[model samples]
Target: MSKRSNWAVPYLIFLVIFVALPLILIVVYAFQGQDGGFTFKNVTNFFTDGDALNTFAVSIEVAIENTLICLLLGYPAAYILANKDLNKSAVTVILFILPMWINALMRTLATAELFNVLGFSLGKGTLLFGLVYDYLPFMIYPIYNVLLKMDTSYAEAAADLGATPVQVFGKVTLPLSMPGISSGILMVFMPTVSTFAISEFLTNNKIKLFGTIIQENINSSMWNYGAALSLIMLLIIGLTTLLLGGDKENAVEGGTV
Candidate 1:
């Protein structure tokens, strides 16, 4: 084998052991009953149980809101950063990423304390603020990377053709940056849907999302049900990733040609 192939052997082994094995176990447990008999009851409970359904709805709502907020905020910030003069842009980008250097748990706790001090009660609103704060960087970086690499010639050409600044941005910049937008949405939405920590910390356990439900079930020894819930979440995230990633690939390919 080539040296490159040899270099991949360790990573392949790690993937199989750490990723594939756990997924196989989850699938197995998802279909198994408490007595270890195969059954679909666990999956059925997710839909039929009112609490489970509500939790799922709440998670979806939070995820959608967080994703939209991130996109709305990140896009303009990324655009400004991408267009700034080199030195200033570099410093600004560093400042934007600085929060990521701190531990996530610490940041969440800090947010919680800050909210408490400001008289904001622990609830969905605080939870959302934490999620947006934590995941906004995920949205910004992807869009910024795409914008930074975009060809200036396209915008120049449009402007030379007598297109106004707004027209150039609408017709050229936004379309070309769609791949990054898709990527950012996927990044923010998937984690927001599945994250338990931010909700737990910021809401002080007052809010129960789908991820919280899964965690509670697992902790309460309802392994099969928890696994089933996890499987459903996995399916939703996988489908979303497939749809958005396909769009991103198409946009990238079109831009290339």
Candidate 2:
């Protein structure tokens, strides 16, 4: 192999050991029974079990809610931060970045404590709040990076053509920023769907997401079942990635046109 290709050897090895091996193990365990024979029981149980199915539904609902909230809040924050006309000082950007510097668990615990001090009841509302607070940065930064790197000449030309500010934004800025929006959606949605800690800590274990179910199964020594659930989650995430990828491609094509 050439010298340039040789540089990827370590990364390939890392993927094989860390990523590929774990996935292979999950697939193996998912298909095997307690007696070590191949069986479809685990997968079937996931669909047939009412509690698991309900938990999965709840997880999807929470993820969708959190993703929407992040998009609505993050987009405006990103737009403001990206727009030099709106935000003059570079120092203001530090306010958002600073929160991310601290550990996520620490942040979650701090948020939970704050809620208690404020006399707020911990439940779905607090869970949603924690989700948004933790993942909003993920949504904002992707859009901010895209908007920062976006071509300004399109907006300038639209203005030159007597387009209103609203028209310029709708016809130009929004289309160009779709790639970032897609990226942000994927980042926020994927984690929220599989997240257990935020739900557990924020709601005091009152609310159980899909991840919590998986964790309980594993903790109770239900390896095959847990792996099946994990595999199912992986498949859903994969399908979402493919769908978003197609949408992103279409958006890029349409924007260019």
Tens-digit lDDT track of model 1 for 1-257? 78889999999999999999999999999999878899999999888999989989999999999999999999998888899564364888988867778888899999999998999889988898899899888888888888888999999999999999999999999998998888888888998888998999999988888899899999999999999999999999999988887776643442331
The TM-scores, one per candidate, come to 0.92, 0.93
Which regions of candidate 1 deviate over 4 angstroms?
Answer: 1-7, 85-87, 247-257
How displaced is residue 257 in candidate 1, in Å?
A: 25
| Colliding residue pairs in candidate 2 | none
Clashes of 2: 0
Cα TM-score of candidate 1 = 0.92
